[model samples]
Target: MGLFTDAYDLFCIPPIMRLIGRVYYGDVDDPKKRYQVPIAITSAMVAIALLGAVIGQLVFGHLGDRMGRRRVLAWCGNWRDYPLSATIMSEFANRRTRGGFIAAVFSMQGFGILASSTVTMAICAIFDAASHSSYEKTPKDADWAWRLILLIGSIPAGLTFYWRMKMPETARYTALVEHNVLQAVNDVRNVLDLPLRNEELPPYPSPLDYPFFSRAFFRRHGRDLFSSAISWFLVDVVFYSTTLVLSQLNDQYLPKKENMNAYQDAYNVARFQALLAICSTIPGYFATVLFIDHIGRVKIQIMGFFFMAIALFAMGIPYFSYWYDHSDRGFLFLYGFTFFFSNFGPNTTTFIVPAELFPARFRSTCHGISGAFGKIGAIVGSIGFYWASQQNEENDHSNAKRITAGLVILGGACIVGVIMTRLFTHETMGRSLDDNENDHVA
Candidate 1:
């Protein structure tokens, strides 16, 4: 649910930005500027949440390590709990099925993205019908539509707060990190409904307490940490840039803004994004759930990045002119595949890896650090792509060339991700978290 709200809140902004422009900035005298939010304002609005996310991931992530995952989560009292969720799920899951379990937790993000598009479409349709407005004229309710979409996003977060507070700490954290063996056994027994035992147990061994950033810590985890952080950073650069620019890309299929009202334009963009979520994003997540454990994280990530690069380059290079001039269908097909490989590949694996790759003591902190880097990438991608698109329009450059350039950069990022995964990361599949971390210590 945290992930669901995160996706909805983040992805819903682009569609509403159009409505916002129409409602507030619609009266500009300059034809190019009319009904468009200024580039500065647009980029700031899109990047602000992601900027906040970087702070939240770092602060909360460290808190989770220090205070305990469940306690910190209750205090967080909001969405954007990716590190906590991944850590808890990874700790609780058995080695054989850990990948699938963590992937399932992250898969809620796909539903959240779908819901954003679907809800926006529904809201636009309802307003259009209620106002009895013609598609040819701007709707007076554009402001209300965008505001309502944002308000609805808060619902899921509110609904999940109590549940987050109620969640028990993971047994691994309770036992290995906290050295509370009896409580850990009780927590697991209660969860699994196993019969209670009256027998006393010996105390568990204390976990190795390596200080973060110390020499021993670096010797054990520096390479994995670098790989996780860099992989997440590169993937998010491509992932977010593609997602945020999708509305603009839909302009090719949409009629001129002058020819249609704000509501109609919002509805069409929402519909197209919803279709992409359904056909590509949602399935991609589930595909990872099914194959991640079997194929292993390292292999799946490599395959995902490789194919994402292929799909992106197909639309960006040698064939850029052909895709742009000839077939909208072909362009969309490649676009859909980029999203598919993202969820099936690095997006899911990056989240899962940090949770298992580190010791229990630093799991949340490491995951948070990796996730914060990913958000930094998101900020760079959103601002950079928006600026590029605005420059193309302002300078009378071809939109196709602007888009192709961005795609080429993203494809290159994915190619680099492939190489980094091969060199720096290792397979976590079929290995217990303790075994994986202990091997590094040894």
Candidate 2:
């Protein structure tokens, strides 16, 4: 499932991002009054995607809590391999280097994208040529090209459903829910590759030991959920804002057309920027994978947010001044700073923490909620960036301080997240999925 999903996800993002430039910003030739609307609407669509995730989370979480983790994991596994795979893979894989694992898996995705991007780029080239023609024709080529790409990519996904529906419920889930001591004993013995010396381990608890939420039960979960969601809300707002804004910043500084004197120049600069991003993600994933067990989830979160606060505060001063001075080189330094703190700190942890703190029963739903709030943040950041950029684009003197203001606000939110992390979030590193079966279930 991870392999399949990563394949789709790794490729989907570059195209989606490329499309954002095309759909919302349009060609750089026809730049709009505000670039914020498209960013906001697309972010809103992301939020909408989480709505389905929320429903799935709630339904599946309850089923998992009532039935067991294995069943939910099985469902999650297959779903991740099929229709829902791409997004899930992207979300998860932004964390670590699974050796050549992600690289190898995403090759199929990359190949698919290579073919599609080629066709699309070809259509784009034709459109560019046609636009320059004396007849001044309107080109609809790229739209159809994108549609065909979507259709072709979706075929493999649609075909995989046949295999998924026939897959069995995970053995762990069956053991707990069926409440059959003998079968449960056999499963544990087989999976662990150990003989079951004790026979009484299986029937230790009744199947009715689930549905673990009532008024008191849900209140506790709600506190954790809301805290988790709010922290993510804060993180996403600043993270996405900073990222999307950096993209605009890059274009402004790099000026693709101006720098296009040679083909290698264009490719080299883009590759250098990509290298920065790839470098940033490495330490963040390593920290999570290595120290998450010893250093603890909340501590890492606190440290990450702290890193952002310091980074943002220092960044704002030069950020405002450099743009005013039109110092492209100086702005490049600030952009690098933004990219580093983003992937190394809040960006990675926001996704990781929710998965860790929430119990398996409610983990998916909480994740959905967190993801939803994150989308809301994206919307605000999107719209806000447009407004700020438009202000900067128009009245050069004051050059709306809104972008600078967003950084400070994000810093503040990180402080809140720190507090919330200390209060409600738990350390789940190295804990097995079945460990939660004994959690406060008198």
Candidate 3:
């Protein structure tokens, strides 16, 4: 449920951004404009939320560790939901089905995307219809439509907050982090709705006495942590940037300004986003939910990254022909593959692995640190891709140059992800979190 809301809020940005850009930036007569967003301001407006995510990941991660997962679990509009949800779900999931379960939980993101696109599409249809009656097809009218989309995104988060709090703390966190055997046992019993014999706490160094970024952590889990952070950073740089910019680039497919209204542009973007989510992105997520455990997270991630790189190259190299011939059908097929393997690959594993690798004591904190790194990648990719998409505006090859360059760069990023996964990630298909923590030890 938390992830569902996060997905809804996170993805609504693409179409909403189109609407916002139309309102604030207005229609530019020069299709050759240097940038879709003011280059200086893009990071502040479009990427600011990611900056908030980095802060939220660190703050909430540390708080989850210090305060315990139950207290720091984010249920609503908090961007920290990225790490917090993963931590909570990882702790609750047992080894037998851990990967599949966590992926399943994370798959709510696909549904959330589905919901956001569907809702936005419905609203766009309404607005497109109403525009004929009102003769108000300008930027001013589009403002309220996008605002309403954001308001709808907030509603689910509000509804789930009270119920999310009702869930009991995970037994692993109680036993491992808090060192409260009886309470842990009770939590497990309540959560499972079954009886369990209370067990005694094992003697070990209290995680409360240790700091996460200390030398002790370096010796134990540093390499794995580095891997998680880098992989997530690479994945999001590609993932978020891809999703965010896809709609932004719709001007190519849109009719020329003389034939297009703000309503038509919005409707096209909404429709594009909806189709991508419904046909490709959601299927990718469910594939991961079904297969992460069977394939192993590391293998899936490595394969996902490799294939994504290939697809990007396939689309990028033929840029001029694709554009002139209206290669959307074939382009979308390759584009859809990239989306598919992404969810079926690193996108899901990156989120799942970090949650499982660290002990409950450091689970959220480490997850946050990893996720924050990913957002940095997101920031870089968002700004860089937009700039790459705008090169040589007046030249005959300008569009081709930008499209080819963005894909080449993003594809290379995925290749780097493949190397990182191979070196740093351990197979955790059926391993317990306790098992993972010890594996990283010398």
Whose lDDT is greatest here?
A: 1
* Structural similarity to truth (TM-score) of each candidate: 0.95, 0.67, 0.91
lDDT of 1 by residue, 138-250 (tens): 57878889999999998988888878878899877888777788888898877778876635333444577669979988888898889999999999998988888755765
Candidate 1 ranges beyond 4 A from true positions = 77-79, 196-205, 318-320, 394-399, 440-442
- The stretch of ten residues in a row with the least summed lDDT in candidate 2 is 82-91
Candidate 2 residue lDDT tens string, 1-442: 3334423333333343443344444444534432223545655554454344445544554454455444444545322322122222222332333212222332333233334444444444544455444232222343453454355555555555554454343343455455555665665566557878555453443333334456745655666667667777777677656654545555554434332212222233334444444444344444454554466556777777777776676656555765645755655565555545554445555555555444434454556556556656665665565456546455554553666665667667767767777787765554543444455344
Overall local distance difference test of candidate 1: 0.85
Candidate 2: list runs displaced more than 4 Å.
Answer: 1-172, 177-213, 257-273, 323-346, 349-363, 384-388, 397-400, 430-435
Residue 93's lDDT within candidate 3 is 78
lDDT of 3 by residue, 1-442 (tens): 7778778887777667666666776656665452144555665776787888888888888888778776777432456866778888888777888888888888888888889878888887788777774344354568799889889887778777876678787777777777787888788778878767764433333344457758877777798799999999999999977876654555656554335556665566667767887788889888888888788999999999999999988877776656545736777788888899899899999999999888778888889999899889888888778767655666757767777778878899999999989998877788877775455443
Candidate 1 differs from the real structure by a C-alpha RMSD in angstroms, to one decimal, of: 2.0
What is the TM-score of candidate 1?
A: 0.95
Cα miss at 298, model 3 (Å)? 0.8
